[model samples]
Target: MKLVLACTAVVLLLSAVELARPMRRRKNSIAQIYRAANITPVPEQILQVNFGGIKVTPGLEVAPEDAVDLPTIGFDFIPGCYYTFLAYNSNYSISFLSPSIVGLYVNLNGDMLADSSAIATWLGPSPSPGTGINRYILNVYKQSGLIDTTDEQLLSYQIDRLRFPIDDFVATYGLSGPVAGTFFLSQYPVFASEDCL
Candidate 1:
């Protein structure tokens, strides 16, 4: 009778242990953003633009990823959304990066590298060598409509300014956009052989 009771006690203990099994809670905060619906409600990806403390010299092939804090996961963007990134070298009398005003890359897809509906490629910063601390004025504007965007670009071209061309670019284009971020990096003279591919 004592053996049967001991066996019953062991069974009960095993059942209790099984019932007390541990379960891990989920940690994905944005996982529940999507649900079963006609129009899938996708969460907006937050974009963070930053220059990774890289000193850019003359004729450097500085990719956009270098400007980004994290290259593996660069600027977060949404498809079908239009965005424009503009940069100006405040140290220079004229901007070699953006020869024209308000358009480093205009009407570009927020997610992709190229401007699908564009006539040219992205113009990067080309601060003249020996310049000290060129404050690159960077801005990102969300296009509300294509017509106004085109109008703004044309209006920006009409403005003729020797200094603070970025100001004219902003005012003419009605940029009124939030400055995504800014960087102050120097460009010094380096030998042709010193260039990095």
Candidate 2:
């Protein structure tokens, strides 16, 4: 009886450990961004977009298991959603690293949507050696006209004032390169209301 009880206890302990392991290893940024934007991040895969006649790739590559931080910059417009925040990149070129504005609309299923311009932020510089990170301040505008309640129009918007942090921009994105470095943007959805303002 003693031997049987000891074995049972060990089995139970191991089961408990197994259950807790996945939760412990879960990514942080995905949860954080989801909670803030009230949306979900797209599954890992290669996403391509065209910007300024250049092809761009954006997705979560660095720290694949970690959650990147995205705080609400501000809100504006009625019956619409406005998201403003800064994206930091320390592994790319200065010309490539800058503020990017992404505008998304909520579909009937409440999924955040993106268009071609979504990845337009990637048309610039390449990464250099020992680059730190570039910080960008962005303002995204969403209006009722752009919002399609029937999912017909498809949410659309533009990115403007794309610039790097003056002080540490150079060191962060490795802007000193003659060749452009490849960087990716997180595919996490940006949540917004489907109703137009």
Specify the poorest-scoring 10-residue window by lDDT in model 2: 173-182
**Cα error, candidate 1, residue 57 (Å):** 16
Give the TM-scores of the predictions, in the order they appear: 0.43, 0.29
Q: Which 10 consecutive residues of model 1 have the lowest summed lDDT?
A: 22-31
Best by lDDT: 1
Q: For model 1, how does the per-residue alpha-carbon lDDT over 1-197 read when each residue is reduced to its tens digit?
A: 99999999999999887766522111122123222211122223222433455543222345433453321113445567666555445556344533332125556566343433432233344445565434444445555444253555444433432243555555555553432332334353354664564
Q: What is the lDDT of residue 160 in candidate 1?
A: 36
lDDT of 2 by residue, 1-197 (tens): 99999999999999999998866554343345434533222212212223333343333233211222222222222333321112333333445643333222221111122321232232232223334333221223222222223332222112432343423422332222111112344322324556742
Residue 18 shift from truth in candidate 2, angstroms: 2.0
